[model samples]
Target: MTTFITNFLEVFYVLIGLIMLFAGIESFRDQENPARIGTGLFWVILAVIFAGAKFLPYLVIGILILILGLLSLFKQIKPGNIKGIDEKVAEKSAQRLGGWIFMPSVVLAILSIVIAQFTPLGGQIGIGISSVVALITAAVMTHANANTTYHDSERMVRSMGTAGILPQLLAMLGAVFTASGVGELTAKAISGVFPVGNHLLGVALYCIAMAVFTMIMGNGFAAFAVITAGIGIPFVVAQGGAPVVVAALGMTSGYCGTLMTPMAANFNSLPVALMEMKDNLGVIKQQAPVATVLLVIQIGLMYVLAF
Candidate 1:
């Protein structure tokens, strides 16, 4: 079962690579982007890494990642001209589909949850399987042909540009930080100023650290690992706090930071770009107050319940 699941994941990765390769090809053909070569090369490198990383040496992968960084540094990775959606066609489709347009998304969410909970394939495989199923559901509902679907998908991917890969890069950074004992260094630094055994202080420290780290990193999952290791386990959990509660609240606390940061391009910037909003920071502005309140409430809850 594990092997099967592993193989399924590999196939999924390859599919993703192929999609990225297609995006690279499209970028090369786009006359609008002045840096089309750089854009295409970025995606092609990413595609190669995704499809062939397992077979490649770690040093080779590292070099490829450096190349990607250099490309970004030189401002080569721009989102070229994405094909605009036809408004009349979109409106007609919207009128025809109405609420049913959301059905595929609903299926994707519910089916993923069901598979993860009920099947031996686990969450990773469940997500991959559910995504494909949802794609098929969307195709059937829209009565779309393969070419149309591919065109739409490619457009969306191109529109995302570098932000699409930011999460993966941040996650890798988290792993590298943890591996380098950054967590231990953090714990040592914080322990000097604030005593470790105080429950309220410990909870506050963990929660605040999670939020601040997430804000800096732009990813809650990335912040969770480092913060949990550095502050959560040592400061809160070790001090008689409930491990599970601390961990859970720690992550959500990080999400509060996600709501406030521009670094989180997918959550904050993507909507503005997609909707053509005048203010790029509008989403974060709206979310900030809510995130702040939630973070404070979660901190209180963690203090009360985790202990």
Candidate 2:
């Protein structure tokens, strides 16, 4: 049963790869494509890396990553139009369904909670399993509207484009950092500068580092594993502090960084485009003051309670 649950999570990645592959194929045939071959090749390459990463050797995956970097460097990936649903039809459907349009999303969250609590899959795999559950529920909710479901699915894949798999890619990169002894090297380097015995300074540095790195990486989650190993555990937790308080506040510090950076494209940039905002930095500007205040409060809290 445990093995089966884990395998079910692995299948989620395969499903994502299949969706990317299908989206890449669709891009190749798009009459309105601006970059044609470049666009198709970009997503197809991502599909290959994502689908085959599990089976491929690390050296080969590294090479694929290099190729992907070069493709991006050349500006190969371009945005496509959103072939959105008709507004009147969407409104009518929403009116027909009322608040139930939100039911599947709520169920998705509930399934994640249930799977994590009751199964051996743990939280990470539980999230993957929840995605699978969400997909199944969506199919059932849509009933026999096969054509619309498929068309809309493909459009969403295309709309998100190469960025669709970014969170997955970032999580895998975080795992790679953890496995490659990066944390140890970082810990040693930082300890030299901060000095380990200065509890207040060490705690301050750890929180600051979490925020800075998370801003750079665009994900607090991806940043958390690496930062916790490199600094939080080494600097804060080792000093007879409350581990729970340190971790909770440390992650919140990272979220402050997420609010401030354009690197967090899904959060900062996507909204601007989706809302047709006049300024690209409008969202960041609004978030900056809030993020700064929160970071200050979190740092203060981490220092106060952690001691």
Candidate 3:
């Protein structure tokens, strides 16, 4: 009975996620609501995360992404606001004549894959290499399509500047701490107090912890790395529940955090910047109630289902 209930909830979550994904994409066809485009991207990312960990019990995310991409290519989804096209031609010409500017990174990525295939660095190294390649590819695509000048890139980078880099740096720092075994020690210390038997309490605490950390850290990726190190994998799994549930619920809680923090400059600050708002915190303040309510609901759901 317990197994059947768990499977049913998992299926329900994935189906709802799929519906949201489709709805968000369909909303994009209405150009007046550029917000829908952003919302669609957010749902798609969430779906990917849910599906990636098998928490939702299916691989629907990849299919959703493909469908969204196809809709985009076919112009079913209206393209919102193309800025600065007048100067784009000049920029592209300069880039085309710039002589293999992106070759070095591309070469390193290919070389890394080759070495990984033949050497002992293994799957991890291969994945790392591929990720670097993918990042470079994405950057190239962005640059090519935007026809952005080096100056424009610099300006955009400088606008967010240090704020943009902080999350990635913190995440890397978290990884280093985990690698040094500090996470293991921390997990053990936390486990000593919590004791890991009550699955309901464990899931609730995990969701709460993830929300708080994400609020502080601003990026859920960093929060996930740190919290999972401290409580998630150890406490939740030891309670005989699935790690997938813990990770999914924890990440959703992090999104709730994203709604309240100025640290999530992409979500919070970008809108302010684009709108030229006098106060950076305006977006955060406006979104706080919604975030809080969602966080509460997510916690309750995690407790009921994950446990």
Candidate 4:
């Protein structure tokens, strides 16, 4: 029962992919849809990635990615909503729920943390189980119907359109970077340029590298795995540095990059388009100062504590 509880989150993900695939097909079949082909291609790529990834060979997955990459590069994706929620109804629900609307999320965080700290389920599995429970709590609290969860989730996917899967795709690219010896190559190159014996410079370099790489990658998460493997564990963690502090602070440094990069379209650009704002770079501009300050703070913390 504990094991089943831990591993069942995959079922939720599979359901999400099915929703995208079906919605894509629905759009493709509709004559009134403005972005039929683009929408279909976009969601099909997302759906196949999530649903078929478990069974598909790595080569086939790579080919699928190449195709999707070419399609995106050539401006072949667009949006057309096939279904969605009534905003007024949703607003009404939120208003009625009041403070309780936050209960599910609060419960999820506490449960995940507690289970991870005390149980053999492990942190990742604990979070997964907690997520499933949280969804149930949300469903019951909102008095949602059998199909409400599925339909509501699908509506969100349809609304986000092409940007929905940007984070996932970028994460895959990070994996490919790791597999292609980029991390090893980068480590060698950097080591040749800088003396790793100087602990202060080495720590600075590692944290800054994480931020710079994250900025380029558009995701702190994607950059974390690569940068940590390349420069983090080797120069900092192994050299009498606190591994946990260095890692946590290094990822925090990477988030500074997320704040300033346009490449993080989902974070920086999507809000502008969604809100119909005049300044395209407004979000990044606003976040830049805060990110820089926080990054400095992280660097200081790492220097003081990690060593």
Highest lDDT: which candidate? 1
Candidate 1 per-residue C-alpha lDDT over 77-189 given as tens digits, one digit per residue, 9 for 90 to 100? 88989888899998999999999999999999999999999998899988888999999999999899988887887788788888789878877876787789887788889
Which is better, 1 or 3, measured by TM-score?
1
Model 3: runs farther than 4 Å from truth? 1-175, 278-280
Please give the distance, in angstroms, between residue 276's alpha carbon in candidate 2 and its true position after superposition. Answer: 10
- lDDT score, residue 51, model 1? 91
Better structure of 1 and 4 per TM-score = 1
What is the number of residue pairs that collide in model 3? 0
Worst 10 residues of 1 by lDDT: 166-175
- Tens-digit lDDT track of model 2 for 1-307: 7787656656776776777777777778776867767777777877787677778898987787777767677887775655677899778877877888787788889888887899777777778877767877877765637677667666788888666656666667767777998877888898777788778887888888889999998889878878888899878898877999988999999999999999999899999999999999899999999999999888888889999
Score every model by TM-score: 0.85, 0.78, 0.46, 0.77
Predicted structure 4: lDDT: 0.80
- Clashing residue pairs in candidate 3 are none
Worst 10 residues of 3 by lDDT: 153-162
TM-score (C-alpha, index-matched) for candidate 1: 0.85
Give me the overall lDDT of model 3: 0.65
Candidates, ranked, lDDT? 1, 2, 4, 3
- Candidate 2: RMSD over Cα atoms? 3.9
- In model 2, the Cα lDDT at residue 18 comes to 74
Candidate closest to the true structure, highest TM-score: 1
Candidate 4, residues 1-307, lDDT tens digits: the string is 6666534555655756787887677657656666577767777777887776667898897888788778678776665555667899889998999999999999899999999899866777677778779989999999988777766665666677666677677677667777898877877888898887677887888888888998998888878878887898668886889999987899889999999999999899999999999999999999999998988888888989988
